[model samples]
Target: MLFAGIDVGSTTSKCVLLSDGEVAGAALVDMGIGTAGPERAYSEALAAAGAAPEDVACCVATGYGRASWKGADLTISELTAHGLGNRFLFPEARTVIDIGGQDAKVIELDAGGRMANFVMNDKCAAGTGRFLEVMAGVLRVPIGELEALAAQAEKAAPISSTCTVFAESEVISQLAAGTPVPDVVAGICVSVASRVAALAKRAGVKEQVCMSGGVARNGGVRRALERALGVPIVWSAQAQLAGALGAALHAWHKSEGQRGEVKYG
Candidate 1:
């Protein structure tokens, strides 16, 4: 049976297609059409799987834009999906930290891989990808190049940015002060990482911290996070697709119901 998961996030939307609990295909895209963006991602992913929408046994929509998804069998919140995806990827993970485009979430997992407690920063974009994008713009470089420069920084400067607008001003001031581009950019990473760490602390972070979402792909942020949290992080090839993966898991359970197979939460 084929199942699908669609994640429409603040910055990007992703969809995953699964066949018999294995990934058949996935599609990623920037949110263009507001709520319909998730549905588009779902359609693209389904096409990548060489399957039509009707062929999917179930399609579970997730993320901020989940409500916009049309033709989904059901919809799940990012909190549940992130927990589900993290547990599915790393059964040992006790904590999950996800930094998306507009928010950062810390999820504490129960022994059964359920969400025990969680905290999120949805009101601010500081700990998310938008902050990085703004800083990268100030540095006059593409977002992709900021990571390399951040990695080479000799010393990260201090950036006090509790908000994106304030952070932009600080970035400009640093540039005018001749603070070294790498140092400034790396400092931005550090600031964001600190915010994430603080959020994780509030949620009672546990060992085996698993970082997911697209921001985890950032080398500077990852390194700073490893330093601030003082623990090793668990990441995988599917790190960026946690929500979509969780949706796929939900689809699997739905398909299992059709087969009358017992499944665990």
Candidate 2:
């Protein structure tokens, strides 16, 4: 049966259509940048999959804006959906780290790919995309360019503050001191990776880790994380879509008259 999933995130929303166990169609769009993008995303996914809403046997909704929409046959946490999706993509992964628009998470998985323990940071904007965006804005550089500049840096400035506001102040100070933009950008990447590493260590991070999230798209962040983590991390090909895909999978199972919650391990 066909199923649908909508992930309404802080910065973007995504929709996925699952045909059996595989992704048949998907789309990612900047949300709140438009109206009811979540519902529209679902409609778009159905169109992309060449299926009608009636063809979708079930729908599951997840992410920060899940509660904002009164859609979906079921609602699940992004954490649960992400964990299941990552495991499905990389069965060997024993640890999962996801850094989305607003927060970061370190999830520990057992050999069976089930969630063992996890920790997150949601109280502040530190170690999130917003933090990186703020620094990019202060440096007068785009987010995509920050990575290239940072990778060329030989020296990274010290950003003592973890708070986004204080860190922005530090970036401005460094720029005023005539510090190279590359070095400043490198520092921010290092700081973010370090912050995430601290959380991973707390959760007892292990090798064979699979990282999923929009932030994983940044190469500089990957390098910094590799250096701090001292391990080559693997990322899912469908990293950003993992949560939504998993939700759709759950939806499919539910529509099969299986009332039991499908747990991924």
Candidate 3:
């Protein structure tokens, strides 16, 4: 049977398809929430899996726009989804650091891979993808190039402002003052890491920490976070699809339960 999961996040949408409890296909779209991104991702995923929507036995939705999707058979919280997904990717993961487009989350997991505690910073964008996007715009650099640019930095410039607007102004000022672009970019990554590190500390960092979400793909931010938290952060190529994959896992479990063949992790 085919099971599907759709994650409609703040700035991206992802879809994952599971065939007989194994990932069959997945797709990610750049647009999200309030847009056609969710449907687009879902359709593309189904197409990739060579299955029609009617072939799906169950569907689950998660993320910021979960409640808005009318196609899902069920909806789950992003925190729970992240925990399950990260654990699936890294069986030893005890903590998960997920930084998305608009928010950051630090989740603690139990020995059984259940979410024990979590701290989220949804009230600000200072440590999120949006913040990095703004900084990139200010520096006239593409967001995707920030990591490579930061790699060349001799020293990271200081950016003390935590507010997005103020930070943007600060970045502009740094440029005006002739601070190297690479240094400023590195500073932005450091600033983001520092803000999220505080949240992770509040949640209590643990060994076998894993990062899941779009921001996890940023090498510069990952390095900065490693330095700030003083621990190795585990990551995978599937990190960005964790939420959707988790939701798909839930869908599979639920579908199996209905058949009286439920399985536990």
Candidate 2 residues 1-265, lDDT tens each?
Answer: 6778888888888888877566777878767324667777777777778888788778898888877757688998888888877777777888888888888988888887678899998588888887888888888888879879988898988885368988888888999999888899989998888888888899997879878888888878878888888998988557888888778867876777432333322
Q: Cα RMSDs of all predictions?
A: 3.2, 3.4, 2.9
Taking all chains together, each candidate's TM-score versus the true structure is: 0.93, 0.91, 0.96
Q: Rank the candidates by lDDT, best first.
A: 3, 1, 2
Q: Which ten residues in a row have the lowest lDDT in candidate 2?
A: 256-265
- Per-model clash counts, in order, read 0, 0, 0
Model 3: residues >4 Å from true position, as ranges? Answer: 257-265
Clashing pairs in 1: none
Per lDDT, the best of the predicted structures is 3
Q: What lDDT does the true structure give each of the candidates?
A: 0.83, 0.80, 0.90
Selected candidate, larger lDDT, 1 vs 3? 3
Candidate 1 per-residue lDDT, tens place, 1-265, comes to 6788888788788988877667788888877337556767777887788888777888888888787777678999898898888787888999999898878899999887778899988688788988898888888898988789998899998997588888889889989999989999899999999989988888887898999998888889988998999998888667778888888888788768532221221
Candidate 3 lDDT over 204-248, as tens digits, reads 999899999999999999999999999999998888899998898
Candidate 3 — worst ten consecutive residues by lDDT sum? 256-265
For candidate 1, the per-residue lDDT at 246 reads 89
Mark the regions of model 2 whose C-alpha exceeds 4 Å error after superposition. 32-35, 257-265
Q: State which candidate, 2 or 3, has the greater lDDT.
A: 3
